[model samples]
Target chain A: AVAAPAIAQSAPTIKWRLASSFPKSLDTIFAAAEVVAQHVKAATGGKFDIQIFAAGELVPGLGVLDAVKDGTVECCHTAGYYFIGKDPTFAFDAAIPFGLNSRQQNAWLWEGGGMELLRDFFKDYNIHNIPCGNTGTQMGGWYRKELKTLADLKGLKMRIGGLGGPVLARLGVVPQQIAAGDIYPALEKGTIDAVEWVGPYDDEKLGFNKVAKYYYYPGFWEGSAQLSLYINQKKFQELPKEYQQILEDACAYAHLEMQARYDIKNVNALRRLAAAGTQLRAFSKEVMSAANKEAFAMYDEYSAKNPKWKKIYEPWKKFRDDELLWFGVAEKSFDDFVHSTRGGKR
Target chain B: AVAAPAIAQSAPTIKWRLASSFPKSLDTIFAAAEVVAQHVKAATGGKFDIQIFAAGELVPGLGVLDAVKDGTVECCHTAGYYFIGKDPTFAFDAAIPFGLNSRQQNAWLWEGGGMELLRDFFKDYNIHNIPCGNTGTQMGGWYRKELKTLADLKGLKMRIGGLGGPVLARLGVVPQQIAAGDIYPALEKGTIDAVEWVGPYDDEKLGFNKVAKYYYYPGFWEGSAQLSLYINQKKFQELPKEYQQILEDACAYAHLEMQARYDIKNVNALRRLAAAGTQLRAFSKEVMSAANKEAFAMYDEYSAKNPKWKKIYEPWKKFRDDELLWFGVAEKSFDDFVHSTRGGKR
Candidate 1:
């Protein structure tokens, strides 16, 4: 009889399925999942393949975490903060209001002891997260009219999500959490005054710029909303060490590629949006100031009440603070001077 | 007879050597090469083992490019810009004076068609480049006394490298290319007034702070110095596709990890240096402004004289310009507001 173990070892073929919390139409955001899949297959010589299922095909879009947790799918590509209701600590893995940008977040997670803290926390949920994608800082929601002050935010009905919604609610705006597929129709019918999806690339695809002519800068909420490949802990541990390493590097490739894709596509989209008569706007000092203050207070409240939040927040806060200081010294100063000379918005 | 092709395919073990352009003592920088080697070996089940040689162990630190080109080593983990003396076009592969930051460089390479341009240029050297590492924005230098204006740079002796040294030469500063081992001694004996190595992490190791009390911000000339894994074209092509990919993914992993390591380590190092009476200083606006003007004019002159430089700089300039504008819009605004509240240096 042929030795079963030897045959399996020689030509090991493993198939994995990933459930995404996004539809296929949002190419830049959802294509990141496929980036991981393609890189995996290419790197492994077709020995390891990750078949991707768009939202609702295998599980509901927002149901990715549950699917992986329940072992329905081996993995998922999703924004971890989507499950903030389950555990507020999930926000750290993605983005929180007034949190780090793409570069800052990567520095924290990869260098600032973030991954280990997150790994231990995730272990409780039977998940292993590999950063797979990031939408560079998102655009603030499109507005029906240009808002000049914090007072303008009061009673403004908008479609926003996660921690941002709660923060905006404190500013007296009504934050409506709408499904992606339904946002445009709701906005067009005046059911909501505005909506925040992603940056220029994804938002342009959704045609939000068409209805809401005033496009804003800095989502401020999700400064680089990170998406991750969450693998079921049991399933991931069962793979050969080679496959595990290969899968991880593939995720790293996708993670870097996603930001690149967004940076280029968003630049072009913003240009096109401006040409198409979308007025670019900045959040006023008053609005941003109030939001920032409210956001920090909320974090403190969570730290006091939620044990998980308290445990992670202690370190997370320090990391974020230090990161801001460092970026101010180097990255920000150079960027500011360059921009001022080039006639950019100050 | 046994089937030769099948037997060859079943166990394809390949061992290679890498020449690193850094000493082993600088773990953060040098270990990036080892990261690629380790990840590749782990991903390939030790089928591809890459032995690493520190600077001067196999070839001199600055000899990595030649070693790969001449097939003395299969590859090198070195800063591409080190070969700028041979061709100014080489600067595009790494960082140039006042060039793109780490995130923007990654965007340009991965998305804005930078890799293709670099690959076309590298063809002349018979090498292929995989962006494998980065030292995020560096410190300007450690100065014996604080620099207040453009006048302060006149006849200042400093140990600097790459395009930065030449750019500084246009200013009143006299650039000194001291060996790393001798930099401390030179600084101690007042032979050199200042030294620019990497950031706090590496600078502290070299003990620049011991003699130089004033440490500066924003090594403006090198916003982000990227290091590449330069592979011999023939050797790369000869490998089975899977090994090639495993190596590529591993390099990407190192690329991501290197910056992460620097960001975190530099933070701690800076803290230590500050505590030890190292006065952190920002280059005055007048100084940064004058340097920026000089750098761009030099680029223009190079574009006129060098055909290779002209070919790449056109697109590179456009990409850099666009990147600056975009960052100004979002990333800078958020960072500026936060830093203002947190008391950042002007």
Candidate 2:
């Protein structure tokens, strides 16, 4: 259980550069990368330290994977969905339309076959993956107008997270792919009808509620958006076993902490949003039903055309379906009763 | 920032023993200490190694806190509620009747001032606590007879987690705190009428389904039972900053992972139990309501007598009540729709 004495005596320090898809302005999301860094440094007694780079500083936001794969940097913190255009299966690593929620996703990655399957896929790109952060189920979006019925989704013209865009499009919604910084201006100037960024914490900061009066949930598309750390395979393997595990444990800390912050922050931010006249809403059953059908249909199409997608989709569908049943019975049942009573207490 | 290189050059290794309240037979629960040890040693280059002693090896399972406080062991991995006889406030650290569920509990600790409040309380015992593991909402328990109404609970003999005992007692339950190993045989031989262990995973191992046909859920007392790593205060403070943070992060890793494993394992185990003719059931609405009512009343009683309980209880109730409202609207609404449709798909 011990390494060579000489290994400690030399005390060589390794410095790494970490690329993050999120800009520094989104502190809660971006801060997760720093959490990993701080914890790793503290664990290793400063023998290792990582410097974080914001989007476009060292590389463009979505280019994190490419940078890590090519060894441009030792690693990058990013959402896997950003690379979905390369292979739609990539979205499963982050979040997909109607995919598992945060608790279920963690179970999948840590226990069920998820980590093994995803690692096999990541191996092809010469990279390793660790869950680094999570933004809990997102808001549907901030809408300029209330979506009263199914027809409201027609030509919705909204900026959305990747995989859901296609699913939404099939339902007659005109989904827009806009840059993050430009979404506010686009919404403010009436170029788009709505936008979904994240949940209340980030949304409040983005001033989405100020411009758009109607706020909706659940984000149907992204149940639990997980951010990952992509490490170059060679560099990861070269680390001492303890250092490697420390990196992973550190990422796990950031992952759980990020979600905790959002869960806690969103409650008060949401209350503030409501007090400020932001109309909180839920998508109509009609809209939700149509979108659900489209999402599963798209999954079917991908399964038929792509063997890699087929391999993951078949099992993922089973995990998701089973989780839904179990959670529906206990989690949902308890929440329903407790929530109603909470209303009475208030 | 770097620690003294001379500190590393000395190659000094500090070995500490971790006492686990669980027996080796309960590997899933007992193994968390090993997980912490393996990770910590790796992070520190094997300079700090923790050897875990299962329950009864050094001291009795429930004596973990006392052992650590008296310096018999440097630390322990045990559930906080096990020490409730000493201070009822201890129940809040693990879980409480009608308390926060796993997600909310996590949010409370990492963000909602729970860690600070609990730490302040732990100070009186001259102990430091780090949340090390969690068992997600447990099975209400294994029942020999179906509970059809609140009246059925009169004089019911059941083995339950701590705080819930008082609540159940108020509603006519003869609460028996049985040893974990003795529970299976106690139920098998008709000594206890019902027993609530953890959920399906651990329950299956204990073979509860073989003897008790009816299985129930949403263990009202422990929505999430958090296992903590309790360190003697002086010893904890003596550690280097790097070592201190490593211990905390390692505990965090184990804490989140324990729940993930339970969430994943329970699904499969529940399936197996069902296949083996286990009569899966939900506690009747009447029973849940009485238990809920009694739980609150008990909390009020504790709040009146215990200063620590009162200080924490005031803020916790507000946090719990508010979270229920928010989760009810979004989380429950989404699950309700999605779960209903999953039935047809299967």
Candidate 3:
């Protein structure tokens, strides 16, 4: 018995199972987990192996956080905001309406004291969180009809992700929760008037364009959605420090790779969708303005009542504001000019 | 006999030297190399160790690339663009005048076929490149006086980086390549009219504010500067696969960390500089517009002359144009709104 522990200290063999809140068909999101697993295994010369299980294999997709918290699996890949029902504070780990974008989120988590705050918050759930990937600002969704004004949203039934639903509901839209497999059919048969998925790459995969002709710009409810790896705290603590560090760097590699995959794939997919006669539309200023107001009001209400929400929200808000101001300066000016130069012509 | 290679495959101790182009004083930039070294060592259970030598200890800052190319050191950390004197194509590996921003560059390199192109290009120099870090969009420079129009740029002597100088020279500016330590004295003594380092964090550390009254926004010359680790190709090929993957992941980890460090540190430093009476100014429309035109023209000239530059530039330009269009839609709208909501009061 003692020899096993001693041998492990040198070159121990360990196996871990990773549950993912996505199906294998959504390769970019699902492959991020595989990226982490492959790098970890390759870096350790196959001493450490992590097997990935897509959603519904080990537990339901929405059940990942609880599964990790209970040590049902060693870890899980998921969007933290999916568990907002348990506590709204979960959104801080993922995305909040009008919050930081993908790059800014990376800055906050890696350097601006976010990881420490999040790590402390996560302690209560017996989970150690590591960022895995981000879906840059998302498309609003696919709609059956055009959105012309704030009134156009009233009573419109749409299938959307969890955290964003409540915000839309406040604008008189009936936000429906539909399974990933069912979203396409729901939109096709007019069971739902609209559906919001990841973006051009994933949305095209789901054939949302086939069912709904109007594809909207900017999923305002989620400026940027971050995905995370939730490791069981006790299991993570018991690893050799070297293995722990290896696992972390592996996640960082996957985190970078996932966004890269999306950026390239989405570019190609958007072109195809456009050629196939998909109508791209922007949300009216009236709608975006109203929704932004409602979203902030909701956050204020939560801050007034929830201590945990207030603690993270205060600093997170400050970081977001500062980043916005800074980015608005150089980054915006350069990008605006370049973008305005259509076709790369001077 | 030949046990060294055999033992190295199974935890044999191996040590290598890393020459960093930056001194230890610039903690964020220099610390990126340390992050890579520390992570690799811990991941390999201390079996693989890398010792870092600051600039001038092993080689001059600008000499690190040639040092790696000639196997003087196992590897070195430096900006690829620093060697543009050898070939302008080196700028693609780092930054070009009005090139892709930090996030866009990451997307292009990791997913948009950029790494392959650059890797092939580096093979000619007996080097294998790994991206190490990035300084997001930089501030233009610390200006002794405000820029009123395009005419003011004529005959202005400014200390700038290597790659951006050519484009500026075409705009009637006399570009000077001054050593980092001497930049402050040169600016203070009125030998140079302006100086562009990194951003506020690094600029403030060098005390640019005391000498230059007016600071400027949007360093158009180098929209984003990327740093890389250049490994001696033959030495890199000799490493075990496990060690190789460990090294790659470590570089990515440091790459992400460096940008995050800059983002947070720059924000705080900008605030401090403003309170201390530093005046932040933007490059006038006339200056930015004229510079933009000349920059693209210079790129066209290089494309017509250098086959290597044309090979990478064509695809890179397309990817850049597509990225600009996409970012302009959702990201720009959301950020513009939130940033305009000054003081987070809205």
For residues A215-269, write the lDDT of model 3, one tens digit per residue: 8888887788899999999999988777788899999999999988888788778
Candidate 3 error regions (>4 Å): A1-9, A343-346, B1-9, B343-346
Give the distance in Å from residue B132's predicted Cα in candidate 3 to where it truly belongs.
Answer: 0.8
Q: TM-score per candidate, in order? A: 0.96, 0.96, 0.96
Tens digit per residue, CA lDDT, model 2, A1-346 = 4765343565567899999999998888898999999888876677778999999999999888999999999999999999988999898899998888888898888877899999998998899999888887888999999999888888889999779999999988888888889999999999999999988778888898878999888898887899999999999998867678778889989988998888888888888888899987888888888988999999999999999999999998888877765665555556555665565431
lDDT for position B64 in model 2:
83
Superior candidate under lDDT, 2 versus 3: 3
In model 2, which runs have C-alpha deviations exceeding 4 angstroms? A5-7, A344-346, B1-7, B344-346
- Mind giving the per-residue lDDT tens digits that candidate 2 earns over B206-268? 899888988877787877788889999998997877678778888878887888777777787
**In angstroms, how far off is A10's CA in candidate 1?**
3.3
Interface RMSD of each: 5.3, 2.8, 5.5
Q: Provide the clashing-pair count of each candidate structure.
A: 0, 0, 0
Per-residue lDDT of A1-346 in model 1, one digit per residue for the tens?
2112221246467799999999999888788889888777766667677899999999999899988998999999998888998988898889998888888788888888888888888998899989888887788979998898889899999999879988999999999978998999999999999999888888989999878889887889987789998999999998877778888998888889889888888777778888899998888878888999999999999999998888888998899877776676666666666666675542
Candidates 2 and 3: which is better by DockQ? Answer: 2
Error of 3 at A116 (Å): 0.9
Q: After superposition, how far is residue B122 of candidate 1 from its true place, in Å?
A: 0.8
Higher-ranked by lDDT: 1 or 3: 3
